[model samples]
Target: MINGSGFEWQESVSQLINVLQRSDFAASFLNSIKAISDFDSAVIMAYGVGPTPKILHDQLDDEYKDAFYDRYLKGAFILSPLYQSYKNNANGFFHINDAAPEGFFDSEYHQKYYCYSGLIDQVFYLKQFGAGVAIVVSLARTRKLPPFSRLEKMALKSIESIIISLVAKNWEKLANDEYKFCDYLNKAFENFGRSVLSKREKDAVNCMLRGSSSKSAAREMGISTETERSYRKTIYNKLNVCSHSEIYHLFFKSLEFADRGEDCDPLSLLWHSAKISH
Candidate 1:
């Protein structure tokens, strides 16, 4: 029951879901976006939490992408109104140069960073995903091309919803997995440093999560205070969280407790409350 272009899009969605479910986190995401949009280049940008909005993945001509990243670091397009407004809101924005302001895309900033970089038409989609609070997926065509047509935009919107749901589900699993792993660590006291923990910087994290203060955690793990601090830093970094409190909020409260039962979830209560509010 599949047609021509419609079937192509359906296949794209299925492939994207698979990638999001099981693939190298960054590479797969970029590949999916590129496939869906039929664009020459795509990059996923994460903002706010990091030192800068990082180009986590880009499938562009390397000479183009590297120069774009380099100029991007030099305050090129970050100041554009289009970029600013997109950063201001957590939503998707799509446009051609004609659709943007008269001088906006023509500014010196735009020309050097975006125009010359081979990005003629652009689509910027921002939302929460993965471990980051704010993630932006930007797809662009370096060559001059028409903006996405009405049907294409609809396809993008549909896929965007699927992407959000998938991210939420995976984060839920990670949270549950972390909680279970922590339980095992607490009771065993056996070295968790080798296998799964090795990839996750587990020993130091387990020590702290099991109620060791940073100083005590360092001593118990037999690493320098600085090394312990560095390990803790990586934990927070990879998790896209700040304090232990935020960690609890994201992984424990939202993901972990939500899985416990509907009766125990604050979001569930809020959902029911909203239903009654109207």
Candidate 2:
């Protein structure tokens, strides 16, 4: 049986059923999770083919909203393993650490951007609607709070099907065609290093963007750490940027180039554009 405040199964189902096809579904669903567990906050995001995910609901405190909406929704999400799961059409339950690539915590992703956003740990309940769309309910515990325990995870897993079904039924009309956006982050990230980098090099660049160290990046790519080091070195030489911060600046600079509406390598465009002519 699920734990925490000890919500009975029948009572939980009734509460959920009442909220179906209603705006309160997300809130009720989160409340049910809280009734059964100890998480502090939750966000329901509708993701589709693009990087832009609509925030269907969030019970975030005022303190965390800036990072959650301002930075996370903008583009940093591309580096998220959760986003990777969505892209790969993943379903079911996952603790951030369980599904994340090894050495995820060591990376400067700022705890995959949560370091900056201020979440210590997270769990997800994802339900993919089709080839092109899904909903991810990201449950989090803030700083100073311990992450969910193994027992809690097991309890959540046991009820995963029920959680997914309720969420899916409620948001039944969601579709990828309905997911749309024209944002600089999406365009810039998609085209950032595509021109100057080879396919393998692009993979390396992605790892770097995710803040994976050479050893971890190599481990994920199934290459030696030395080879990963070489890839990073080569990328630095190819891009003429000495540090991660410079690469980031290049990424930001590319957003300006991306504004021109072409999906070409923003780095190449940034260097060659008349706008930057001195």
Best by lDDT: 2
Model 2 over residues 12-101: C-alpha lDDT tens digits?
Answer: 788789779887777878878866666776899887745478889998878888988887776677668788788678999999886677
Whole-model Cα lDDT of every candidate shown, in order: 0.51, 0.77
**In candidate 1, which residue pairs clash?**
118-142
Candidate 1: tens digits of C-alpha lDDT, residues 219-261: 7678787888888788777655686545333322233123233
Model 1 vs truth, CA RMSD? 20.2
Worst 10 residues of 2 by lDDT: 1-10
Q: Candidate 1 — what's its lDDT?
A: 0.51
Off by over 4 Å in 2: 1-9, 49-51, 176-187, 256-262, 273-277
Query: What global local distance difference test value does model 2 have?
Result: 0.77
Query: Which window of 10 residues has the lowest lDDT sum in candidate 1?
Result: 181-190
Q: Which stretches of candidate 1 lie above 4 Å from their native place?
A: 1-4, 15-25, 33-36, 96-102, 129-132, 144-151, 167-278
TM-score of each: 0.49, 0.88
